[model samples]
Target: CIILQIIPSFGLPAGLFLVLLIGIDRLLSVYFPIFYKFKNVRRYLMYHGLAIICYALLQYSFAYVYFEDRNVICGPPEIYQGKAKALWGSLSFTVIILSVILYYAVWRKLKNTPSMANDHRLFRSILAIMGVLILGWLLTITMFVLVVFLLDWRGLFSNIHLQSL
Candidate 1:
């Protein structure tokens, strides 16, 4: 139970952060090919370091909150439950929107390139990959929304019961 709660706190944020990085990388390569090509190792290392810091912060915060109660089956106490879902949902939506924008930019760029103009295979592959990624994120966002709604509904009912007592 403890492990389950701890893993997602770090894992989901890191995974979403990687998606954002990929989108940014794709946009950079597309719009500023020369700059992307000329980017030094230090710049790349700095981006990686930032990602690490974000992951560490998420992990420590979640662990600190959940560690005080060993009986928590799968998440923080009721008071903190909906917050995680909301946070993940927002992140997923942001990633989805960024991916859409980046994919559209790549498509437009590819369409205008003489060499890639007739290459249906490359376009098809890119579209397929993007479709998969978008679908996955959409699924995650849907689940998070549902969980948050359900948790809130349950909390409301529990509160009513407490008032009655």
Candidate 2:
């Protein structure tokens, strides 16, 4: 049960970071095609793999803050609240915003470069996937912010009134 709870806490931020990584990969490929192509594959993989490991460790620290109390019910409504939720939300929001900027830059670069016409399909697919992810996160964060502001935290989490409705 604890592992199940930890899975989402670990996965959500990691997944968001992965999307941002993809954006970075696209941005570099578009802006520095020669450098990107000639870079050693093993070195790049090693760097990115190390980055993932470091990021996971950082997120694990944040998760420690959130899970410090060990609530009886391990769901979001029970576990996520106040400062911990706000911190995670802000981090996720920042990643999404950065991703949008990166992808937009990539799109513009791709559009202006007639020489790279053949790569449009690949860029389009990445753009599409990121678009869906961005929208989903926006909606989720919007609702979370609304819920946080519109109702008292206790009412939303503890009272059981929301479940009735």
Candidate 3:
């Protein structure tokens, strides 16, 4: 029950980090080739480290999210019921959607560039994962929403439900 919080706590940020990484990398490759080519390895590593920290913050944010004062479920479904569903929901999926669009754009643009080489493959893989993530989240959200509404309709969800992220 309590462990279910781990899904949004860590999942949102982890997904965001990947989305940001691939999105930013694709943008750099297409519009800032020179800078991308000459980027410092140390800076690159630091950037990734920063991404990691961002993920951590997002994960821990759940700790402070609103939890329902009372609830009913086999597990803690109401743990993050109404903190701010729209914000976190948008944040999680927006990154995924953007990643998909950005990767495809970069890939099409770089298709003919000889320099694309192994990097193209990287983008290809990113694109694939973006698809997977997008699909996974979409399906999960759809089911969760269906359940939420079902509970709400049937008067299963408690009034005390709350969450911020």
TM-score of each: 0.64, 0.78, 0.62
RMSD in angstroms, all models? 5.7, 3.9, 7.6
Write model 2 residue lDDT over 27-106, tens digit each, in one string.
Answer: 99989989999999898888877776666556656556665555566663344555666666666667778888998999
- Candidate 1 — number of clashing residue pairs? 0
Which run of 10 residues does model 3 get worst, by summed lDDT? Answer: 156-165
How do the candidates rank by lDDT, highest first?
2, 1, 3
Error of 1 at 117 (Å): 7.6
- Between candidates 2 and 3, which one is better according to lDDT? 2
Off by over 4 Å in 2: 1-3, 66-81, 149-165
Score each candidate by Cα lDDT: 0.62, 0.73, 0.62
Positional deviation of residue 123's Cα in model 2 after best superposition, in angstroms: 1.1
How much RMSD separates candidate 1 from the native structure? 5.7
Query: What's the true lDDT of residue 147 in model 1?
Result: 64
Which should have the higher lDDT, number 1 or number 3? 1
Give me the runs in candidate 1 sitting further than 4 Å from their true place.
2-5, 55-80, 116-127, 146-165
lDDT of 3: 0.62
